[model samples]
Target: MPTKIEKDSYTGTDTTGHEWDGIKELNTPIPSWWVWVFVASIIFSIVYVILYPAIPLTDSATQGVLGWSQRDTLATELAVRDEGRADITASISEADAAIVEQDHTLRTFALRGGAAAFAENCAPCHGAGGGGRPGYPVLADDDWIWGGTLSAIQETIRVGIRSGHDDERYAEMPAFADMLPQGERIAIAHFVAGLTGKGDPAKAAAGAVPYQDNCASCHGEDGTAVEDTGAPSLNDAIWIYGSDTGSILKQISNPQHGVMPAWEGRLDPVTIKMLAIYVHNLGGGLQEDAGL
Candidate 1:
């Protein structure tokens, strides 16, 4: 039988007619405020489902009554941004690269754009500020294997060195390992290393004759390098391979040839022009006439 409901004598409260060791069970009702709050939450959820995208289907989600979408919002914002940049982009596209450098505003925009592009595309091999890695050339220094003029920099960025592009600037040092005797190679390395004043005097003297006969054609007799042949100066402290005697010897035996990819078709003209401008301003850029 069901337990009978009755009032308890101790506190005048209603209790079910069931007890465990003389303690009766009380039937308490939920608070009205809590019940109403729970009901409100259910109602709010229904309203939200109707107002915004809630249910997902096989191909897409429910398009709510408001018709709002994250993609549309992003597109609208991008359109606004593009509108703002339209004039600047047009100016850059139309103007000659050299003429663009003469305008302060245009030059500033190019520098900023170029820095961003360089960081994204060029910073992997060249350091963040064009400091250069082991095989890469230091862009911020005056010791350019090719020329360092603004036009030169632009052309280099466009076609690249040793790249497969038709107009690429190409140069290669003949590997002397097979052609020259081991003693001659070592002597030449010593002579070349001594050009920077860091080699053994006795070894350098012994190597002088070999160097004059074989290496002097491209790298001038004075070791100052002929820029046209892309021969780097041996007399300078800057060593592309390295400054140590061992490194010089390795280069003499089998030289390292670094290749850079052409950016002409890959990047837009405006971007390439900007990159040239940015690289040119990096501490060691030459004036037009001076570089030529």
Candidate 2:
């Protein structure tokens, strides 16, 4: 059933003991270098299996000879990084927030730390750059509901505004929908809108008497809101809720109050101080002596 092996007459090469359509396959041995390389690869694979975690078992992989793990290496790297920053962190922890600005190194460290903290904690409500969201007040503007000095900012961060914290800066506007007639509320809304040049002048004039009787106590007769009461100035164009007539009406009916969480117990004091500094430097912070 088998053909006898023989050397091909044309090429002088030995043929395998088989033939197909008068052609025979040449019996050529694999190269020694290639065979040795393939054998070496098998040996290397065996060594690797013994030296490193390879085979998967029921609960975990096999513990290799070295016992080294990626998680352990990462933990070691993190510990080294923490050690490097320990001195700066400790310096900030001990330094007074107000005096931190005097030291360039401390201030730089504080700004970096404060930025990271703000992103982690405050970015959800106040926005990445403190530009504020719809219901939240802008931190990068001259308008401030509470005082805006460094001390004031620090205090606000510590206690928060309208938060449940005992020390929170609290302010409340009566829901006029429950107190005043609908017509009077509308007129008051118009008047408030007119303060920023946005509503009917005649309606605003008609509403002046009602506004004087109801709003003048907290907001001055000239509509300049009293800072002590945390009332925003109506004379200015800046409106926390909005400046349009519809927005004014909604606020007059049922006022929306903003709340900030107390950071005193949550974040460290040095971090809070750093936050205050970062917020105050956002182009609209006030100086200690600056009037509200």
RMSD of each: 3.5, 3.1
lDDT for each candidate structure: 0.88, 0.86
**lDDT tens digits, residues 61-150, model 1?**
998898888999999999999899899988988998887888999999999999999998898998989999988888899877788888
Q: Pairs clashing in candidate 2? A: none
In candidate 1 the C-alpha lDDT for residue 178 amounts to 90
Worst 10 residues of 2 by lDDT: 93-102
How much does candidate 1 score in TM-score? Answer: 0.85
- Residue by residue across 208-243, what tens digits does model 2's lDDT show? 999999998888787898777988888886777888
Off by over 4 Å in 2: 1-41
How many Å off is the CA of 111 in candidate 2? 1.8
TM-score between model 2 and native: 0.85
Every model's TM-score: 0.85, 0.85
